[model samples]
Target: MNELDLIQQLREGDEHAFKTLVESYQDLVYNTALGIVQNAEDAEDISQEVFIKVYRSVHTFKGESKISTWLYRITVSTALDLLRSRKSKKRFSFLQRLFGDNNEPLQEVPDFNHPGVALDQKENAARLFKAINQLPENQKVAFTLHKLEDLSYQEISEVMKVSVSAVESLMHRAKQNLKKILEKDNEE
Candidate 1:
């Protein structure tokens, strides 16, 4: 089905349309979330939440952009929210560590298995992602969307609500940042 037809079906509460939408976009959603959060379980939860939000708010879609654009916005926002919540938890954990009563260790993310990467490249991809996690949020998002999600500057501009030039700058900075991070890791 075409984009508008599928969107109209979704808005009209067609179960088949919803199913098609989910099946069509789930990998995009899951990969985007996984790239940011770097956890399989969290990415799965975020994918479910994204679909649920789409189901609940389909009527509000203004159709100014494509449905994929809408999905990108929602997925990015949801994934960033999860990261913010994790930051908050890490802060609390820091506080707990600062105090005398030590309950548990700070959460450590295991090496991510990037679905898009070749088996031989998994280690390098994991290192890249580890460095990526340390980047500032905007840089990280821009990089992930461009490199991992394979989005163009124009598409990223649309999803991020920024100008195409801004996306370019972000990509430049992200690349520079990643270079520094990888170099540092290699030196160690």
Candidate 2:
């Protein structure tokens, strides 16, 4: 069944249709969450939350856009909420350090892949992910939904609740930023 048909079935309270919908879009939702959260465990939690929200609010989704677009919106919003919560915690920790005399270093150990792994495409992918991380939130969302998720400009615009032209602009800027970062890396 097409997405619209599946949505209609879901609206009609068909449990099987809901399962099919979840099965179809689960990867997209999970990956999007993973990109934003950058942690597998948190992404899994956020992905489940996205689907629950989608199932409960599916009735409010007027068919103005594709079901995938609606799903993307939910996924992005959930991830953003998680990011905000993490930021708040970090800020609180920083404030606590300012008031307390505990001089423990805040360290994050990088998880190194096996040294036997060649630095071919993996390095490029890492560079690309780093560059994507540096993008402003809106541009990052547009770029992630477009290049990473392979959503069309129209679909992203609907998901982001922006004009198609605006999405195009954000994507263009994102590409330019990535290109500049890559160029600077090459020069170094």
**Every model's Cα RMSD, please?**
1.1, 3.6
Residue pairs with colliding backbones in model 1 are none
The window of 10 residues in a row where model 1 has the poorest summed lDDT is 100-109
Candidate 1 structure quality by residue, lDDT tens digits, 50-141: 99999999999988998888998899899999999989988988898889567787766777888889999989999999999999999999
lDDT of 2 by residue, 1-188 (tens): 98788888988989999899889989989888777666678879998998899889889988887877788888898898887887797777777778885455555524322222357766666677777777888998888777657888988888898899999899899999999988987899
Best by lDDT: 1
Stretches of candidate 1 exceeding 4 Å from the true structure: none
